[model samples]
Target: MLTKNRAASFWNGVRMRTLAASPDPDEPPRMVTVPADWDQDAGAAFAAMAPGTGRASLADASMLWVGPLADHPQASHGLATRLLDLLLRRAAAPLPAVWHGLRGSAPGFVLNLAAFAQPEGGLEIDDFVQACETLAEAMHLLQPSGQTPCSLLLSNLDACLAALGLDYDSDPARAVAACLCALATTAMHPHSVPSRPGASAGSVPPASPVPGLTRFALARWQEAALRGRRSGRSPTHELLPETGPIETGLTAPGHALASWTDALLGVEACGAAPLFSPLRPDGRLAASTLARLAARGMSPEAALAASLAGNPVVAIAGPAATETMHRAITPFLDRAPEAPTEVQAPMRAAAGGGRRELPARRSGFTQKATVGGHAIYLRTGEYEDGRLGELSIAPARGSPVQRGLLEAVSQAVSLGLQHGVPLESYVETFAYARLGPGGAVEGDEAVGSATSTLDYVFRTLAHAYLGRSLPDQPQNAVPAEEPDDALLPLDLPRETHRPSGPRRRHGLRLVG
Candidate 1:
């Protein structure tokens, strides 16, 4: 039986309606309600979700609710306090914070200082920096001892920059980022003496004992990112200032920004800590990104090779604050079997051709057909956007050798597709290939005739995926008709034969 005290400890005084333990199958389910200990405002915020959305739990240890400071500038302090209080009660000690959403655990806490995606011209530069300053002050009040760690994230910064007619990879935007980082760092260390200009790395003043923000970083593109665009979303181009761009893995300026900010925080750089991670879900490049690369006449393999060349290894900062974070992450070090010997450069020169991965669960179909009495089965898998990503080919009736050969071919094709080889290239190469099994195709209306099973397979793929309908070759479809104007073969007027006599006798007669 769960007691009220036990429930209080588990839920941190949050109200919960749950079923009581009952062994009796015949007994009715009894609902138990535990009253909340927190105030009504936080409780109501926790219980009632925004319309058109389901309720979410604050009890999750990994989650950090970063309320929009732009929406409620005055409430930043109160909101931060309430959230921190709730988290402290619920989350385990030395809270976990994830900086890189891709390859690392989340941060203990993340706070949004400004809503950068303002489409309307209402946002001002002063206002944006002011909001950050205000949030920093609020954070200091909540954690005056600097014991509790928090990170500041600027959401929709890219869209905000675009709205202001600023390029993401330019100097002006970086100036804005530097200004924000400086302000937050000052607020975080209000009592500590400022470090002198050009101070030696070892001569910088020791960090303050007061609790404040640990560092700052740019946030990834959100679902609401497209809203900030005056002309609306684009099919070809994606908004900039994201964690990483599709065209290039990580922008050079973005990486420099992360490194600069971490340096401002007086810490060493680690793997994608202050900004973006190059890794994708499947530990490979995304099929869609590869396809886009292929469309641009760029070779995906070449791009990958260039990006991975001479990458700087990563290391964790040795500060005492990072010790707990380090211990928390030790278990996940070996999670990825192919993780590099050293972490990819956290903040360094820009690299291209990042891994694009298929989702754990994918969508696709299987196809069956016959070419000249040969049974062939074709299966395909697609990415999230229904782009063909994987292919499998098999023969229903074939010897072990033949089956092995077909399997090898399918595997090769599938790798090519994933690596950004266009389907058109494959279709053009194999469409009219001639071999055995020349005749009609069955179980598919798209292809009527083929010279070989390979021909039928590629032709069908061309019609289905590329929308290119290829006509069967005349020689393969039927025997070619002879032309009346064809030239006749010529023969020698007289046939010449070697002498039947031995060479020695002929030589002697000639000499005599």
Candidate 2:
């Protein structure tokens, strides 16, 4: 058993078992290398399929990427190459089937291919311009009708064209700009009646007078004199030579002067975009033009507010909530503006003949009293644990008018809540009522009275039970009083006595 040959055989068997039980330590891991030329080839293929680009080269490259030749070391290499091929093919052919395929695939590859198709520094000016045009055309063809996809492609195209210093006069940039403007116009004026059935196909106006394809465009055109000023270049004459002559309708002499004044003021407020911003420095509208629109009764603040409030689902509940909120609060300035302040209640009683109920709770202890030109309503009731409740509303503590207004507001809120209206909807309705035409009088009197009553009830309950302190009432405290004539009568259930425990003694005497 101890022989050298026998021992060597035994060691060999142990080694074999160990090797089978665990992974090999001696063997190196298999190495893989992805071809660096893959991205370049894919990019070339995509470029070829672009409009004004070589379609044949694109097709050939796409076939090579997707075929057996694409069996590269990197697993993603084949997929990436194939996607580029498909993108180029789609750009060239643009069939509905290809569009469906694109919708299902990763957007990253398509975006990358678009980026690659843009002109690089190494490309000659003519070649670069041609590539830019082709890329623009492809992007225009692929632009989605739905908002999300359209926004993505629109943003990409804007960036690419801007980098190349392409203007709206250029084929692709102009085409793409037209599409974006259509989207913006649709968003702004969805209910706009079409001029004619088929004539409205490509008739979307830009958001503002400026073709703000990007944030930079907005910045560039925000100011008055600086709007068309780009590196001392006159944008109107150089970039947008097609801009038609400004047409002014006949107006009264006084109105025209006022309009000019308004325009001058607007030009002073906003400024131009910074140099660092990414946008094409062209297509800005003049401040004077915007002023004219304002003179025609176009309130920017009101328009923005309407836009914010119109979309019940998305702008309110979705990603645009914050933006909507900003729009809703935007302010406007008008000549001879009145000072902003809360409404004051008049001393005269409302027109109603009937002796209205006092805007106070029906709690058994307090009373309504008038003091210092204001009404003060006191209330008392039982709290959650049978504790005493007390509360008071002294409208005259600040201003008699303000007190009355507050009382009315409180009443309206309570009545609306009691009627099962949602809090938000009720608030919006109330705000509208106060601000809308022929609504002020109704809100101040009738609506206010109802809300005041509700406020009294809620305050009485809240003070009696919900407040922090829970001290017992004094023994000699004033006795409970009867409810006011205006208040609705409450019917309380009668208390009955009950045994606390079983009467064992009645059945049998227990001996301990």
Candidate 3:
């Protein structure tokens, strides 16, 4: 049932090149031309890749293949291991191996670099730098065909920052990023350095060079990222030159650049590759971005800058990242899908927050009752976690105007609850309102009486969700009857003479 294009995408993700195909047939093709050395296991590996994504694999048509990077021995921590397992399971393709093959490589591979941190904090700078080195070495040795440009994504970055005992978004994390980049890039691109008998003390040695392995090159989008941040504006392709290498901030040993400038540059003055992190698909932050930065008390701008300074460990926002990758693989993609544009990209809430939608099949209950003899129906909806998410009130008996008003009020309250408004706020505002439909016994046992329907609704919610009870109002008192003589004044009224036309009358007339 797989379409030829979909199948091709799967094969591409698994690194199996399709050399040729048979003439069109009515049914899906069983076989196709591939490398003689192609491992059947590799092809099988992608059969269930990202199955939940409704595609053969994430690499199939994704702009950037992003996932967490795992250590060789695997993480000793359960949480780290479980997360890695989940990501790899969803991705289906194995690291390094999925990146292999002479036919072609992925447009880019984003490795979640933060996965290397220990769950229990206290990760030292040297240990982290060594971990980066180990990863670079392992990747280089595994994938002899170095066509794939791997990016170490700093997703879940704050956790790693915590492990390092560094404050989030502080200068310390940036400093560590630069140091790690210098050491790791040296390992990934050793040929850039001249031959020497031995590495100097405290200097990170380069790994043996691999043929066709490209030195770290800045993606076009990364330069735009730097420009955008520096100018405090969004960068456009038009503003970028057609041809030029971005200054990688490399400096001479005796240069007059200030110490702050050197630290800010984040790279050593060597002919080493510049590290840059790719943005998420369509230039939006990934779920991991929120977790790594915002939730951890870091800012997006800080993460982007750290990424630019030779730490391939951060997933950042950039105008060019997606466009550049799209350009690289467009030829292989099916023509039906349109390339993502900045304007067309979906916007998401930032600051480590996002809308949590309710499930399609929701759970709820309706309560029928009367408040102050005004019949009402109350309904409630809950989230998967059993939290209240929606509420609706309907009057069983009322004027058309009253019904409409109640409907509108219910909708407004429901919207607020769905948008994360607390139940307590509604309770405080409406629980004891003395409005029409005032004073009543409700069918519901929880609330025996209420000043108004809203009072009943909120009081019910308070009891159900807030675990608090409201006391009923005091009973109304009866008034005493007054004597008829009480209406008379205490003193007798003076009589006034009427006009001559009126005969003597016993009735007294009041003067004007």
Question: lDDT per model, in order?
Answer: 0.39, 0.26, 0.40
lDDT string for model 2 (1-512, tens) is: 00011111122112101011101123232111111222222222223222232222333433442343235332333343434433433211222222223442211111211232233331122322233233322332333222212111111222333333432123434433333323322221122211222232323322322233333322322332243333454322122122111110111111212212111111111111001111111223222223322434545555446436642110101112212211211110001111111111121123232222222222233334332123444433322334332222332122224434543554344333333334444333432222211111111111222123333333233333444221222323344455333332345322244366632223322244
> Residue-wise lDDT of candidate 3 within 1-512, one digit each (tens)?
12232233233233334322211123233333222233332232222222222223323322122222233243233423333232332211123323332224322122233444443333333433344444443333333354444322212333344344443334445434333334333333322321122223223212212111112212222333344566654221111122111111122122221111221111111111111112221235543444455444667777768656744234222213323332322221111013333322342233124445555445555577777666677767677887777665666434335655775676567656765778889899997777677766657888887888888988988888889998876546223344334344467543354466523433533344
Model 3 clash pairs? 152-312, 153-313, 154-313, 154-314, 372-440
Q: Could you list the CA RMSD of all candidates, in the order they appear?
A: 24.5, 27.2, 25.3
lDDT (tens digit, per residue) of candidate 1 on 153-267: 3222333333343333444444343333334333333222123222232221112211121122111111122233443444122322212111101111223222222211111
> Against the hidden true structure, what lDDT does model 3 obtain?
0.40
Give the lowest summed-lDDT range of ten residues in model 1.
Answer: 243-252
In model 3, how large is the Cα lDDT of residue 311? 45
Off-target runs (Cα >4 Å) in candidate 1 are 1-355, 475-512
Candidate 2 vs candidate 3, lDDT winner = 3
TM-score, one value per model: 0.27, 0.17, 0.26
Count the clashes in each prediction. Answer: 17, 5, 5
lDDT ranking, best first = 3, 1, 2
